[model samples]
Each structure stands twice: as C-alpha cells, then as structure tokens.
Target: MFSDRLGAAAQAIQAQFKHTLGQLDDVPVVRAMRHATHGGKRLRGFLVIESARLHGISSAQSIWAATAVEALHAYSLVHDDLPCMDDDDLRRGKPTVHRKWDEATAVLAGDALQTLAFELVTRSEASPEPAVRAELALRLARASGAEGMVLGQALDIAAETAEAPLSLDDITRLQHGKTGALIEWSATAGAVLAQADAAPLLRYARALGLAFQIADDVLDVTGDSATVGKAVGKDASAGKATFVSLLGLEAARRRAADLVSEACDSLEGYGAEAETLKEAARFVVTRAH
Candidate 1:
C-alpha cells in the first residue's frame, strides 16, 4: 500500500513538473531542467503528501509544496553531480545534467529549479493563507540554504581534503544538516499548513533522515552502479568515512533498523493513520536506490 501510494505521489510530482516546465521557454537550459528533474524515488515529495494527508489537507493544495520540495531536491542533485562537485557522469541511470549538456547549462538549470521551488511553494494554490505560504517558503529557504543542505555539502567537500577522516559524530552532524534538514521540513509541512503541532513529525523525520543516510552508505558499499542508477563504491574509492566504513556493514544495518524503529515509534500519537509513514521508514533501509 505504501509503495502504491509512493508511486502515485511520484506520478503526481512528475506531472506537476511537466506542467510547470512546459510553461517555460523551450531551450537548452529548460530542457536541462526537465532532464535533471525527470525521475527518482520521489521519497521527499511522498513525505510531503503523506504528511499532508495525515493532517486532513487536500492533495490539490499540498501537491504544490510536494512538487516544490522535489524541485529543490532535483536542483541539489544537479549541482552535486557537477564537475566541480562529485563529477558524476550518471544519475537515475542516465547521463547527469552536466554530462548530457554543458556545465554552464547544468548550472543555469539548477539555479532555475531552485528558484522554481520558491515560486511553486509561494503560489496562492499552495495555501489560501499568506502566513502559511510564507512559513513554507521560509522553512524551505532555511532547509536548502547555507544553514542546512549547503552547510552539510560544504563540510563534505572539506572532509575530502582534511588531514583526518571525519568522526562518527562529525558525520552525523554533517548529515543532519545536509539530508535531515529538508526531510524535517517535508515531514512537518502538513502540520505547518494546518497550524497543527509538528513536534511528533519532526521527531519521526530526524530518525528517518539518519536511517536514510545510513542506508545510502550501505548501498554505496554493496549496490551495483546500474542498480543504484549512479556510481557505486565512490565513498570507499575516495577513502571517505561512512557509516559502513566506520561501523561495519552489519553494525550499520543494525543502526539503521534501530533508527527506523525509533521513527515508527514517534508516530504513536497518530495511531493507524500513520502506518504509511511508518512503512516509509522501513522502506528506507530496505530500498536498493
């Protein structure tokens, strides 16, 4: 059921992408934007939709925020795969934006997507109340800007040249900013829209985000590039410290499981209505990509 819901959400997100991008001028940069945002698990958007559903928010209103987060995520991935960054050639089993186009086109596409995220979230359709739209945009800016994902990314790049490998605590802190921040925002967006308390969902996201990152670390160690839809074993090849490298594969798996349990437990207040989110937490650790 969760898988079906996730798939449905992914479709909705892709359609929204098509509708939004179709309105833009048809050019190389716009095409690059479409290419970069084409496909993924759409887990972040699913989180936004599911959380919105839990709050009795209609999909019509919530889809804007959901699509906005996905656009932001796509922008991050495009930049992350640039030659100045990860220098990856593949993403979602296709040539990355820079590899498919040029680095300048990729950069412009990423920038456009980033701005589009704000445009989507701030649109009147996303929320009737100006306050709610403002809150969503504000939180999104924080999550994706220097204090959040960007901070984590900067730290990660710095780690590559550091004399010493990052410690477990350092890695955890880094991931909290880079990955956990946006996840927290997505999970809490519904509550923000409804003016409900977000504490429980926030707790759920914190654990889920860490588990998600650990699972990614595991995938890097064990997944094939084709299966992963990107380069695998890059972390190991770079001699970067990851959960797997630090805790060993079995221990890292155990830790992710524990985090998933914690994430599920945080939804106790929502009872059976939270089952989809709980299932999502479980899926995080078990997913191949």
Candidate 2:
C-alpha cells in the first residue's frame, strides 16, 4: 500500500507537469531536467501524504506539499550527480542528469527545479496558508543549504581525506545533515500542514533518518548495483566514512534496529494511522531496493 500510494502520487504529479514549465527546449538544460525528474520513486512525497492523512489533513494540501518536496529531491539528485559531487553516470537505470547533459546545464536545471519546488507548494490548488508556505520554504532552504545537506556532503568529502578515521558519531552527524534532515522535514511538513503538533513526528523522523542512513550503509556493502540503481560499495572503495566504517556490519545492523525502535516509540499517541510510518522505519532497515 505504501509503495502504491507513492506510485499513484508520482503519476499525478507527472500529469500535473506534462507539457508545462514553458518553452522547454531540447537543449542540454532541458535534457538534464528531464533526466532528473523523470523516474524518481517519490518516497518523500508519499511520506508527506501518509503523514498528513494521519492528522486528518486534506489530500489536496498533502499533494501540494508532496509535489514540492519531490521537486527539491529531484533537484538534489541532479546536483549530487554532477562531476563535482557524486559524479555518478547512472540513476534509476538511466544516465544521470550531468551524464546526459553538460555540467553547466545540469547545474542550471537543478537550480530551476529547486526554485520551482517552492513555487509549486506556494501556488498549489490546495495550498497551505501563506504562513505555512513561508515555513516550508524556510525549512527546505535550511535543509538544502550550507547548514545542512551541502555541509554534510562537504564533511563526507573531507572525511575521505582527513587524517583521523571517522567515528560512529561523525557518521551520525553527517547522515543527520545529508539524508536525515530532508526526510525529517518531509515528515514535519506534513504534520505542519495538518495543523498537528510536529514535535513527536520530528523526533520520530530523526531516528528514522539515522536508521535510513545506516541501512544505506548495509546495502552499499551487501546489495548489488542493479538493485540499488547506483554504484554500490563506493564508500568502502573510496575510504569514506560510513556507519559500516565506524561500526562493523553486525553492530551497524543492530544500531539500525535500535533506531527503528526509537522511531516507533515516538508515536505513542498517533494510534493506527502511524502504522504505515512504523512500517516505514522497519522497511528502511530491511529493504533491498
């Protein structure tokens, strides 16, 4: 059901953008945009909708929020795939944005997508209040900015060459900044839109965020590229910091389980609506794809 919801929402969003976005040329920029936005699984969007439903929020409003978050996620992938970042050649079984188009075009496409994300949320058919839109924009910016993802990435790069080996704590800090913050924001944004108290969910998101990254580490060590859709074992090969690097695989797995338990506990009062989210936490640790 969770995956179904994600796929259905992604279809709707794709329809919403079909033949839109103005004069899209066949230029490198447009190609980059198409590559980055075309095939995402849109897990972030699903989380938004599901979390909103848990709080009795309108589906339309959730859709607006979800689409906006997904756009930014697409933007991040575009930039992350650049030669300057992950420098990957494939994503979702296709050439990455920068691999299909020139670096400059990829960069511009990412910028446009990021800005478009905010615009969509603010202008949605069932938008949140202006104040809510403002908050969303602020949160997204902070999550993507130097204080968050970018900085975390910088830490990752440096740890690759730093004199000291990365500790488990360092891995947590990096994950919180890189993967965890966006995931948390996606969850919190949904709660915010529902006019629900975000505190519990935010804490839940934090634990889930860390668990997700640790599971990513395990996958990198054990999964194949065909399943992951990206280079596997790149961290170990590159000598980068990872939960696996800091803790042995067995220990990392245990830590991820602990994080999942923490996440589930944070939902003490959310009742059955939170069942999906609880499953998501376990899924994060156990998924093969």
Candidate 3:
C-alpha cells in the first residue's frame, strides 16, 4: 500500500510538472528544467498528498502543493550540482543539469523552476480559498529561502573552510534548516489546507527529516555511487563532519532507528490512518537511495 501510494504520487506530480513545463517554448532552458525535475522518489510530494488525505482533503486540491514542492526541490538540486557548488556530475542516475547543458542554461532553468513553484502553489486550482493559497505560498518562500534551506547551504559552505569540523549540535542545527524545514512544510501543508491543527504532523516531520539525513550519511559510507545515484563518500573525502563522522556507524544507525520510532510515534493521534506515514519514516532509514 505504501509503495502504491508513493508510485501514484510520483506519477501524478510528473504529469503536473510536464503539463506546466509544456506551456513554455521548446528551448534548452525549458528542456533542462524538464530534465532536472524528471524523476525522484517524490517523497516530499507523497507527504503532502498523504497528509492531505489524513485531513480529508481532496487530491485535486493537494496535488498543486505536491508539484510545487517538487519543483522547488528540483531547483535546489540543479543549483547544488553546479561547479561552484557541490560540483556533482550525476543526480537520480542521470547527468547533472549543468553537465548535460551549459552552466548558463542550468542557472536559468533553476531560476524558472523556483518561480514555477510559487505559481503552482498560488494558483486558484490549488485551493478555492485565497487565504489558504496565500498561506501556502508564504510558508513555501520561508521554507526554501534564506531562512531555511539556503541558510543551511550557506552554513555548509562555510563549514568546508572552517578550522575544525562541525560539532554534532552544529550539524543538527544546520540540517534543521537545510533539510528539515521543507519536510516540515510538506508534512504540515495538508493540515493548513484543511484548517486543521498541524502540530502533530510538524513533530512527526522534525524527527523524520533528521533521521532522513542521518540515513543519507549512513548510505554515503555504505553505498556506492551507482546504488546511491550520486557521489558517495564525499563527506569523508572533503573531511566534512556528518552524523557518521560524529557518531560511529553503529551509533548513527541506532540514532536513525530511534528517530524513525519517534517519527512514527508522533502519528499516534491518527492511528491506523497514518500507517503509510509510519512506513515512510521506516523507509527513510532503510532505503537504498
């Protein structure tokens, strides 16, 4: 059931993204945008849709938020892969946008995708209530902007040049902004759309997001580039501190498992209705990529 829901969400977002990108002229920038957003686990989108389902929201209305987050995520990836950034050569098992096209086209495509995210979330189709749409757009900007993901990225960049590796506390704080912020937004967006209280889901997401990053660190140590779909062992090579670096491998694995348990526990209010979410948290730690 979890796989089915995940697959359905991925396909739905892909169609929405294709339809939206189709409106633009067939050019390199547009092609790059399409390529960049083409595929992923679509876990963020799934969280939005599933959380919406838990709140009795319609998939039609929730799909916009799903696609919006995916577009924003794609933008982050494109920029992150640039030579000046992570200098990654591959993503999702395909050539990075900057590698496939020129740097100029990659930049433009990322910029376009970022804007498209807001457009998708703010569109009337996303929610009948203008207030809800406005809230979604506002929060999305906060989650993706300097105060959130970008702040984390900035800190990460600075850490590369720091005299000492980051402490566990520092990395946790950084991940809260860089990765946790968007996950929190996606998980809570459904409650916002339905005018329901989001505190529970917000708690769930905070634990899930950190555990997700810890799992990535674990995979970096244990996975190969082909299996992980990107470069592996980068933190070690760069001498950057990560959960695996701070905590031993066995300890890091235990921490992620504990966090997944915490994440699942946070959904107790929803009972059986949240089984997929529980499964999702488990998957975050256990996934091969």
Candidate that would win on lDDT: 1
User: Which residue pairs collide in model 3, if any?
Assistant: none
Candidate 2 error regions (>4 Å): 19-27, 124-128
Q: lDDT per residue, candidate 3, 1-289, as tens digits?
A: 8999999999999999989999999999999999999989999999999999999998998999999999999999999999999999999999999999989999999999999999999999999999999999999999998989999999999999999889999999899888998999999999999989999999999999999999999999999999889999999999999999999999999999999999999999998999999999999999999
Please list the C-alpha lDDT of all candidates, in the order they appear. 0.96, 0.80, 0.95
lDDT of 2 by residue, 174-210 (tens): 8898898889888887777766689998999999989
Record all residue pairs in model 2 with backbone atoms less than 3 Å apart, i.e. clashing: none
User: Any runs in candidate 3 off by more than 4 Å, and if so which?
Assistant: none
Name model 1 segments beyond 4 Å from true: none
Q: What is the lDDT ranking, best to worst?
A: 1, 3, 2
Cα RMSD of all models vs. native, in order, equals: 0.5, 1.9, 0.6
Q: Write the per-residue lDDT of candidate 1 for residues 246-277, one digit (tens) a residue.
A: 99999999999999999999999999999999
